[model samples]
Target: MSTHPHAPQSHVHDTLVVGGGPGGLTAAIYLRRFTRDVALVDKGNSRLRLIPVSHNYPGFPEGVPGTTLLGNLTAQLERYGGTVTHGEILGLRIEDGVFVADCLPEGAPDDARREIRAHTVLLATGVADAGLPIEMWREAIAFGSVRLCPVCDGFDVMDKHIAVATSEVNPVGHALFMRTFSAEVTLFERMSPTALTDDDRRRLAAAGVRLVDSPLLSVTLDASMKPVLHTEDGQEHGADVFYPMLGENARSGLAAKLGAETAQCEEIVVDVHGATSVPGLYAIGDVTVGLNQIAVATGQAARAATHIHNRLPPALRTASTRPPSPGTTM
Candidate 1:
């Protein structure tokens, strides 16, 4: 582990990526390839870590397991001389044109914290599912029986039994959207004051969607590992897949702490190149209010890195033969 005592010269990085998800890793790889010193700090709790298999992640016709994909990304980053650290960032601040970050190691002592200083910072903390009310939830996702992003995997459930689960005040739209992929669709309005207006009910009826107001009793897998949604009333709904439309909590505190502007859904607002309102501060991936997809994240990372590289002085610019800085720890 690299320990920084807030030394005047040590522990300084050209770029500090605050998440180990696809976005952060991609940025680290690009920045390192640009011959810039970069460090990635992550605690392994990204939303991507929960995906059992992503069939739409491109280049994988059969699909890729989340862990396997992360492993490959890490290997590639290390090969490019990017440092990976396992820690949770607690706070961020700007001082004298430098960004300072405090990170807490996963299992270290409470008092054992490290501070990292960076010329630039990339916020890729992503978002977390707001709430999921299901037993064996992780297993359900692993079996592809429960999904979160409809745009990413909606085609997989085409013409199959599907359910839309939402705890929002109104789930009519989500339920209707799911109906586009399957005729046998059910809306599970669980514990939400969610009600359908007469017009909403008529639309659902027209779309052949069944709306149920009962709260979910449980979600379990049978012998064949198929998902089964049980309701409080003794009604059982078996579906090939279910969508959780609960919501997402964007992990943009690091950006907000630096006084960056936020758009709808509290997502960190960034320019097309992923630069935040605060210069040298950038955000990408689900932390921004966009089409939260892996491909989009990687693209944002590449653009951000290129922009950052252009801002460097000609002498400081990285070169193919330039070795990494020695004082900074990975």
Candidate 2:
């Protein structure tokens, strides 16, 4: 937790990056190399463990998992020269020439919070899965069954029986991607197919996707940790792989509250430099409108770091010198 309350934060350093996913870590890496005093705060992205392997990312011909990618990025950040604080940012604001943030550690913080007054702030708050939490969902996750964003984990479903549980008429590109892995793909839309357009219907039909238009009532986990979803229309379906093609609301509430432009899913509209509507508050990753992937997030953060470094105020901005002392002349 960090912030700057009163006078301009001349000592709070160069930047404070929030959310240590791909984006935040990349931002820190670039900022540290440029000699900026940057700190990273993460709420521990839980989705890391679920991504079995990711092939879309370049440099890894065999592909890598979300957890492994994040771990390597963390090491790079620490090695290059960035401090990491495990916490959640509660508040943020901009002063004369610095950005201020108020935060506290996880669990309980009776205001054990600290203030980080810096020259810039990069908000890489990625997205959280948007859905009604069914009790059995947790059980499904542990057994590596119910997958989110199949594009990120669908490869593991090769030659296996898989079902898509969602509320979209066609579930868009998901049914297509899943079909490549498992021919036994069952597309379950918790709604009526009539809600879909003629083109949507044609595309799905051409794709040979089986559509199940029924409301999902509940999820029952079997002994093997497989999910047996009971539909409201009294249909029972089971699959070796349960893919929730359901959509999600981005983690942009904080940015929105600060007057950053937002749209559906709270995806903030950020420029190429990660600059938002506000001057000091910036964004990266799926929380913004650009492509939502590990590589996209990492690239956006790197570019944001370069942009922020170039825009730092003269006071908080530092060169290759020792940290300025309290009474030291500027």
Candidate 3:
């Protein structure tokens, strides 16, 4: 938090990272190498927040949990003397030549509302919850039953009967990934399914996956339908676990409103340097077009940080050790 005339505007930040998750945090570290005036603002709930232990994060031989990894990242960024603020950026608008981020102290426990005017802004706020229709989905999530990101939660379902509900829209993708665990695997297509090619049938058969093309009757914990998926077709199938890879929204409305071209798939559009179509605004991590793993997010952050730094004008650049000014509270 910095101060100035309006809200006690602080020293001009070389880069303002609008998400403290993987991409934003990584960007802060890289930005600090060139200029210490970078700030990372996040609402505090990362996409990986629900993740338990992540084996694919790289570097951790035993694999670290998502929260622990975030803690380590925060510690590393703070060590670089970068400003990491917990706040929710409610609105993003470009004022004059600077990007002005309007956020309340949502992520911070302290009651402080402020804005950051930076030479450049990175939109790492990421995506949102794509709508999903499921019985007991929310309750199970709150009770630590149903989970997101199979890579993060599949291990817990090992040796359990797993039900993968892929709407007619997306089929055949998760079969390979979810098969890492769950000995009894069932794939359910709610609508009429497209014909699976020989390769599709072969790979699935190799993995001991049963294919079911039927409309879902219901998913209940205590129903006689219990673990079994009682389809309208008068068939009984059991499932100790269920995974839905239906849809997800990449918190990209801000970038889209800014007029950046978006891909039709599940992510945002960005150049090799992680710069979005909008100049001075970049994106990275799960929200960006790359591997959604932590290592990839960390790498993307590092790359975007350097890219933004090199693009900065000489006047905006500061000494590597320069400390951020204290926040001017509102």
Candidate 2 achieves a global lDDT of 0.74
Cα lDDT of candidate 1 equals 0.81
TM-score quality measure for candidate 2:
0.83
RMSD of each: 5.1, 5.8, 6.5
Write down the lDDT of every candidate, Cα atoms only: 0.81, 0.74, 0.70
- After the best TM-score superposition of candidate 3, give how far the Cα of residue 329 lies from its true spot, in angstroms: 42
Kindly list the per-residue Cα lDDT of model 2 for residues 184-301, writing each as its tens digit: 7777666544355567667778878777767666667778888787777898888787777667768887788779999767899888798999877889988898667788888888
lDDT of 3 by residue, 158-257 (tens): 7877788664444666766787886687887665444566787788788888888676666555453234456768876666666766566677776777
TM-score of 3: 0.77
By lDDT, is 1 or 2 better? 1
Candidate order by decreasing lDDT: 1, 2, 3
Task: Put down candidate 1 lDDT per residue, 93-166, tens digits, no spaces.
Answer: 98888898887878988798888888889999898777756768888787788888888888888998888875
Lowest lDDT 10-residue stretch of candidate 2: 1-10
Weakest ten-residue segment in model 1 by summed lDDT: 1-10
Better-scoring candidate (TM-score), 1 or 2: 1
